[model samples]
Target: MKTTGKVWKYGDDVNTDVIFPGKYTYTIKDRAEMAKVALEDLDPEFTKSAKAGDIIVGGKNWGCGSSREQAVSCLKERGIGAIIAKGFARIYYRNCLNEGLPIIVSSEAVDAIEAGEEVTVDFDAGQIVTKKGTFPFPPYPEFVRGLIEDGGLIPHVKKSLGLS
Candidate 1:
């Protein structure tokens, strides 16, 4: 159960630099420090102003740059509940899922929404409730969603799949 805050909107092709700036790569000794620098290009204050359940709306290629694990760590640390975008880079998407970052791909979600709206995500129902209306996303498998619920791929695999 994640609640939404003022929506933050972004354009298409938001790459890794937007997610994890190059200036912070060398400073990746800590996730809190790395999060302070997240989205340096879009919103330097994002990490500061972000609250739990805040949704990020962006266009295609929402994570098109490097495959740095810190990128996801930053957002998670900032209390970003989920990301809704038109699309995501293959590597970045996988990294997000592996890190238990809930990312949804939907053009309508990006194009038809504005900033500063409360949204409620019901994972079991697979729906997002905004002040405007309820928007449904494509179904996610129980297993995959379970993985995300377990707090990332590694933990999910360890618990669900019983692996080391």
Candidate 2:
């Protein structure tokens, strides 16, 4: 699979609290509503400016706080094409995969990419290309790609079972 988009850069240690904010959890049950406040604490204009297929690039330890699934859900709901981070909190990484959000671990790309620059990620080829340069990384395993392609674990499992 491949995706191309303008980048949205963020710093290290972006926690779940900033991603979804615990304050709204109780009041917001709808994914689209939750997405409106996504990264609002960090970048108040994100919801207004970000578009479908835009990528998020971040520094090391991205997603380092709580394991709130909304962090992943919010990004998905907002139509983030993928996230490229120097590193990821283990739980958040798994959560992204579980929610069918494409996330790549690429310190090189994270360090090199600038916010608003156009980028292309080739998942099948494991490469990220930009005006600056091209960076290569390992591609996701087939099973994981299958999960994402099928729109997360539940759908993947259901497909495996011929349920949907």
Candidate 3:
């Protein structure tokens, strides 16, 4: 659970349509289907080849587009360990928070990191350790991080008060 993840880099303005195509979404099938089209514009093999705990690093304004919860869901289904980007679109950022995924905004780290590089992510301390150096980025709010730790806000809330 504490192992480092494999990094995969991307550029800016990666819209939701690119993550989950509008056509495929209507099926409402399993996540595996949705994941196939995830990031299709950038890399068609993303869903097929990406493994659990593999990291996604990207440039500014990442995840920019529709406010589809499916975007975050699809990534989670594909076993994305975390996302480190220079910047993130507002709605997509909130969606990731709701899903309890660790998405950090780190231009310094993003610029220095590369695909397949092993790196450590500290959600609590907001730290990132790469081969060249270590840096701290903005951490999620305490409550939000708690939700992330519990694997999404809805489940976290339910488990917190023993509602589930």
Candidate 4:
């Protein structure tokens, strides 16, 4: 799979509350509405400007704090195609995969990328291409790639069972 988008850069230790405010966790159930508040506390302009397939580039400990799936969901709902970071919180990483939002770990790429620059992620080749250059990351296993392609775990399972 391949994804191309403009970058939305951020720094270290960005927690779940910033990704999607904890206060709205119980109130916002609609996906589109969830997107509206995404990064409101961290980057107020994000919800206003982000377009489908825009990429989020983050520094170390990205997605740290809490296991709120809404954090991942809000970004996914906002049409964020992928997240490239120096590192990720484990639960948040899992949450991204579960929600079909691609998360990548590449400190090199994160450092090289700038906000508003366009990038193309070639998942099949495991390369992140930027004007600075191309950086390599390990390719996802076929099963994992399949899960993302099918839109997370539930849809993948349903497809495997011929129920979708």
Candidate 5:
């Protein structure tokens, strides 16, 4: 799988609340509506400026707080192609995978990529390419990749059960 897009850079320790603030947690149940407010608290213009295939790069400890899955869902709903971070909170990382959001752990790429720069991620090769250089990361295992391809765990399970 490959994804290419302009980068949206973020700092370290970005929590779930900022990704999808709690203010709307109870009020918004629709995916599209939730996406409209994604990252608004952290970057007021994110929802307005981020396009369907944009990539997000972040410093260490990205997704550091709360385990709210909306954080991943909102990004996916907005059509974010993938997220690359120096490090990720354990639960958040698992959440992303569960939700079929492509997330990578790469300090080098996070440090080198600048906001607005175009980047290409090759999941099959586990590499990220930019004007700066090519950075490598570990490829996802086949099963996980399948889950992501199927649009998350639930869908993957449904397909496995011959229900989809």
Candidate 6:
């Protein structure tokens, strides 16, 4: 898969609470509603202005804290195409994949990508193309990429079983 989008850069240790505030974890069950409050605590404008296909760039340990699925779902609901970080909290990384949110870990790419810059990510090529230059990261495995392409684990499974 390939996507081109504007960058929404952030820092390290951006927890699940900040991504999708805990206060509404139980209250907001709908995906659309959850997206409306995404990044409310960390980047309020994001909830209002982030466009479809926008990419999030982050420093080390992005998505740290509780194992709230909302954190990943909200962004996916908001139409985030992908997230690139220096590193990711283990569970959050898995959550992203399970939710069909592609994530790339490339400290060099993270350091170079600037907020608001239009960048193109070629998942198949494992390249992030910026005006500055192109950076390469390990591409997802074919099976994993297929999982994302099919829209997460459940959808992929259902399709494999001829249920969808």
Per-candidate Cα lDDT values, in order, are 0.79, 0.89, 0.81, 0.92, 0.91, 0.92
Candidate 4: residue pairs that collide: none
Write model 3 residue lDDT over 1-164, tens digit each, in one string. Answer: 34368888888888888877767667857877666667776787775688888889988888888888888888887778788998999999989988877788889999999787999887666789999799887766788767777888889879978998
Task: List TM-scores for all candidates, in order.
Answer: 0.88, 0.94, 0.89, 0.94, 0.95, 0.94
Error of 1 at 60 (Å): 1.0
lDDT of 6 by residue, 27-63 (tens): 9999999988999999988888999899999999999
Higher-TM-score candidate among 4 and 5?
5
Instruction: Give the CA lDDT, 0 to 100, for residue 120 in model 6.
Output: 93
Residue range with the least summed lDDT across 10 consecutive positions in model 4: 139-148
Candidate 1 deviant stretches above 4 angstroms: 160-164
TM-score result, candidate 4? 0.94
Write model 1 residue lDDT over 73-111, tens digit each, in one string. 888888788888899999988898888888888776567
The predicted structure with the larger TM-score, 3 or 6, is 6
Residue 92 Cα positional deviation in candidate 4, in Å, after optimal superposition: 0.6
TM-score, prediction 2? 0.94
Score residue 97 of candidate 4 by CA lDDT: 83
C-alpha positional error of residue 15 in candidate 6 after TM-score superposition, expressed in Å: 0.4
What lDDT tens digits, residue by residue, belong to model 2 across residues 55-115? 9998888888888898889889999999999999999998999999999998888888998
All predictions: root-mean-square deviation over Cα? Answer: 2.0, 1.2, 1.9, 1.3, 1.2, 1.2
Point out where model 2 deviates above 4 Å.
none
| lDDT head-to-head 1 vs 6, winner | 6
| List of clashing residue pairs for candidate 6 | none
Model 1 pairs whose backbones collide: 6-116, 7-116
Q: Given candidate 5, what's the lDDT at residue 121?
A: 96
